[model samples]
Target: MKKICLTIIMGLVIVFLNGCEKVLEKTPDGQTTIDKVLNDFARSKGLIDAAYNEVYQARDQIAFVFSPLESLTDNAFWAATYNPYRWHNGSLSLSDPVITWDWSSPNDQLWSDFWRGIRLANNAIKYLPQSTVITEEQRAEWIAEARVLRCWYYMQLLEFYGPMPWIEEPIEPNYAGWNELVRPGYDEIVTRLESELLDVINANIFKPRVGAVDAKRVTNGIAYAIRARLLLYNASPLNNPENDRTKWQRAADAAQDVIDLPSYRLVPMSEYKRLFIGANTTPVDEIIWRAWTDNSHINNTNGVDVGSYPFASISHMWNCGESPSQELVDAFEMTNGALPVTYNDATHTTVTVTPEAAALGYSEATGGDPYSNRDARFYINIVHNMYNYGVPYNCTEPYIIETFVGGRNGFNDVISQETQRSCPGYYSGKDKQVKYWGPGNSGEGNEPTHWVLFRLAEFYLQKAEALCELGDPDAAATALNVIRERALQPRIQDVPGFANTQEFLRERIRNERRVEYCLEGQYRFIDQRRWKILNETNRFITGMRITKGGNGQFSYQRKKIRDYQSYTDKYLVMPIPLEDAKKMTSMLQPKAWQ
Candidate 1:
C-alpha cells in the first residue's frame, strides 16, 4: 500500500494559481485516475491551489510579483549585469540570456515561466468543469479563478513579447504544427482576453474580498482592476496604433468600475506606507490585488533593503544597489506648487534650492538637504540627502540619510567605493523597510516585502490619463486631484500660473504617474512606451553631484552618470524569446528587433 501511494503521488503534478506548492494525499490504491481525482472536491481544489501558487513561481520559489524588471526603467539603476541593467543600458539583444532560455538556470527563462503558468491554468480550466464530485457552483467559481490567471499570464506575455499565440485549450505534446504556430496580432489578442475577462466578471463567480483566507484568491475587485489595467494597456499608443479615443473612453470606464467598488479606497496618507512595507495581518484597503503570503509580513529577503536602502540607514547586511536617478528626483514638485528645483550656480548657492525654497520650510541656504519641502509623496518614496530612514532596528529615532558626495552614504564614500554613482538616493519607507532584525540578520534580504500590484491610487491616475488623452483636461484634473489630495500636495489647478491646456495637463499627468508609481513595478516604463516618449524624455539619464563649498554649504551639480545609455525605439517592446522564435518559423519578432 505504501509503495502504491508513493508511486501515485510521485506521478501526480498539480499546478496552483499562486504558483506555490503544497503536499497532497497519496492515492489509497494504484488505481488513481484523472477522472477519480477530478471527482473529489478536495483533490480538484488541490489542483486549483497549485495553479494559484504557480502564478508567482519564478524558478523553484515564489518571487515578488514586481520583478526586478522595475530597475530596468528610468526610475532605478541596479549596477549589476542582470537583464534589468542590460535592458536599461540598451545592451540587450534577441540572443540575450534573458530573452533566450538558459536551460540550466530556471529563473532566467521569463518566457517559459509565464508560459508554464498559462498551461497550468488552462489545464485546471479544462478539467474543473468535468469534475463530478463538485457541484456546478464550485466548478463555476474554480473555473473563473483559473481563467483570471490565464488572462493575467497572457497579459504578461503580450506586454513584453507583443502578440503571443492565443491558447484557449490545453495543447498536447504530440499536437501537430506546434513549432510553426504564429502569434496573433495585438487586436485579436486584446479582444480575446477582454472577452474572457468579461465572461468571468459577469459570471458572479468570485467572492467580495476580505482578509487572509480570501486574500490571495481572485475576487470581484481584482478582476475589475485587471480589466481596467488591460483596457489602459490596449489604449496605449504602442498597442493602439490608430490612436483611438474610444479605447481611452473604455479604459476610463473600466477604471471607474474599480473606483466604484465599495471595498477599494486609498488608505489614508498616515496608513499609506503600511500598504507596501509593514507586517499586516489583514489586507489593506488600498490594495485591490496582491500576491498573498501566509506569513504575516511580505519577505524582502532579496536584499531589497541592502539594494534600495542607503548605507547610512545602519543596515545589518550589504547595502546599496538600485539607486534612483536624479532625473526621477527632479520629477518631484515643490510643496508650493512650483516646478522641480533646478541648478543655478549664480543666483542660488546650491543646486538644490528652488525659487520656492522659503515656502518649503527649509532654513538652510547652503542646501545640504536637497529634498526639503517637496511633494509629500517624495518623503514616502525617495531617499535623498538628509532625509530620515525611519526608526532604526535598535529603536532609535529615524536616521537622517546622507547621500551627498562625502556624506556617510555618498557615492564617493569609502563604504560605497565599489560603485560611485550619484546620491539623490532612493529609500523605501518604514512600511516597506524592515524595522526589526530577523533571525541572525540573515533575514535582511528575506525581510517581509509585499508587492501592491494594484491600488486605488493607480486607478485615480489611470482615469486622469485616459481623460487627458480623450481631450478633457478639466475632467482629467478632477480625477488627478483625488490622488493629489491623498498625497497632501497642491492640486492640479492650485499650481499658480500653470496653464490647463491639454498639452500642459498631459505633461502633469505623465509626471504625476512617474513620481506616484516610481519603482513599484514597470509603471514608468509602460507609460513612456505607451506615449512613445522614451526617445524624447529619456534621451540621457542624469545623476547629481554634491561638492562642499568654501563656506561649508553643499553645492550640487546634475551630471550624466557614466556607462549609462538611454534606450532607443527598439526598447519600447522586448523581442520574443529567441528559443521560442527559432522554433516557430512564422513567429514574428518585434519590429524593432528585426
Candidate 2:
C-alpha cells in the first residue's frame, strides 16, 4: 500500500492522503504511519473531522457554478463557462472539456470521495477506541459517530452509483486482494447499512440530538433520517423494480422512527429561510444533520455558508452563477394552494392552469409579474425580477433583481462578460446573502452556515411517499399535510382532485418535494431518477425571458434554453467513473451504461 501510495487505495478505500501526495508525513522505516497517527486522542479525534471533511468537500460539487448538482436537475441552470456543462446533460466523462483531465480540486469524481470518506470513518472507528486518553463514554459515542458517518457516505454512494461492494472494516495497509470484490445487490446494501445503523441506535450510545454547537456531528436523529431516506429510495421504482409493498412499509416505518424522535420538528415557516443561512446557537431541532465546513478545507470566521452560489447575484464579483429555471419556478403553487401552471408535455411549451384559480386571481400568465402570492417557500427560495439581491449588509437601500432584456441582470444569447446576463428569470434566494459575504458580511465569499442535510420536513415527505406506496393514503396524507401546512399551503386532502385517488395523492406529495427541496442537494435530481420520470423532468429546460416596457413593467415569456436526449434509460443511476469501474472488474459499469 505504501509503495503505490495511491490517492485511491486498490479497493474503494482511501488509506493515505495529503492532497494525494506520496506521504502526508514521514516517519522512521519501522514506525508504521497508522501507529504514529493514532498515538493520542487529539490525532484520533482529528480522523473524525477528516471523515466529515470528505462529505463537506463533496458539497463544493454543488457550490456556485463550479459543478452544481441542481444544474443536472430541472431546478437551476448553471450557465457559467468555468466548468464543462456536459454533466448537466449526462455526458460528463473522461472527455469532458473543462474538467477533462483534472479530478483533483473540483473533486467532481465523487466515487473517489465517497470511498475516501468511508476509509476515514473506518480509521476513526478502528483507532479511536484504542486511544488511552478517551474515556469509556467518549469511546462509545465516537464509535457510534464513526459507524453512522460511514453509513451516511454509503447512503450517498448508493444514491449516486447504485449498489456497491460492502467494505466494513478499514482495508489494512497490507491487505492485497481488493480486486476480488464485486458489487452487491441493493438488498444486501440496504441490509448491511440498515443493520449497522440499527445496531448503533440500539446501542444507545449516540446523542439523541445535537445542539447547533455540535450540529455537524452525527447524532441519533440523523441515523434514523438517513435510514428513512435510504429505504424510501430503495422502495422507489428504480431500486424496487418489483413494486415491493414490504419495502415501502419498511421505508414508512423508518421515517416514523425519525418522527418519533421528540427533539426534531419543523422550524416554523417564518424561520425557514433563516434556518438555511443564519447561525443558531440553540437550534430548534429543525435540521437533523447540519453539516458545516470544518475549517480543514474552507476558512470562515462567520457562520457556515450554505455553499455560496446564491450570493447577491447581481454583484459584479458574484455574478449570477446559477439561474433558477422557469420550470422550477412554475412548480411552486400559488399561496392559496393552486398550482400556477401545468404542462401538456415536458418540453414546457404547452401551459395550462386551473380555471378556478384563474377566476380567483391566481395565475402564472405573464401579463404582469406572475410570482405574486406563491407558496411561502417560493419567496424564501427564489429571487425573481423585482426581488432584492446584491444588497450590502449595512445599506438601507435594496437592490432589486433586474432580469429583463437589456436590464442589469439581462438575458445572455451567448457566453458573455455579464454572467447574470444568461440568467433565466430568477436567481436562487438566500436573503441573508448580504450577511454571508464574508466575516461580518465583509464582501468576501466564504461564509459558513449550518448547511442542512437531513431535516424534519424532508422526513415528513419521505414518510408520506412511503406510506402512499404502501397503500395507506390516509396516513400518508397526514404526513403530507404536515409539509403542506408548514409551507402555508392547502392540505393534500383539501386539494380538490388530489384526495380523490392514491395516484393523485402520490403526485401531490411528489410536487411538494419538488418545491420544498428546490435547488437542494440532489433531492430533485435523484427523485426524478428513482421515480423513473426523467422523460418528464429532463427533456428540456426553460428560462423566463423578461422584456421591460416603458411603463416600468416587465413582460415574461418562457424560452427554451436547450433540449436534451441525453437522459436515456441508463441515466436512472449514474455510472461509476471509468477509471474506478475498470479496477472493480466484476461490476464494470451499470449494465445500461455499458
- Most accurate candidate by TM-score: 2
- Top model number, lDDT: 2
All candidates' lDDT scores?
0.64, 0.66
lDDT of 1: 0.64
Q: Write the per-residue lDDT of candidate 1 for residues 1-594, one digit (tens) a residue.
A: 000001122134432211223233344475677777776777777556655754542211222222245455666654534444445567667766343333333334456656766866777787777778887777888889988988888877776767788876755433456466786878778778888888888888786655656667887777788788888998988889898899999999998999998887787788767776634346678887665542213223222233234333333433344567766777888787776565564222245544565465533335545567688878777766666665535444455566656665565322122243333344434234545433234344323455667788888999998999999999999999998888887888988557889889888888999888886665776787778877766654456666666777776666555333545878788776555566566877878877
Candidate 2 lDDT, 38-114, residue by residue in tens = 66565556666566766643233443234446666777766644442565556644323222225354344456567
Model 1 CA deviation exceeding 4 Å by range: 1-33, 39-41, 57-67, 97-107, 279-281, 294-315, 342-354, 357-369, 412-426, 437-447, 548-552
- TM-scores, all candidates, are 0.84, 0.86
For model 2, the superposed segments whose C-alpha errors exceed 4 Å read 1-32, 57-65, 81-84, 94-108, 208-213, 294-315, 344-346, 360-367, 389-391, 415-418, 430-432, 436-441, 444-448
Q: For model 2, where is the 10-residue window of minimal lDDT?
A: 1-10
Tell me the lDDT of model 1 at 406. 60
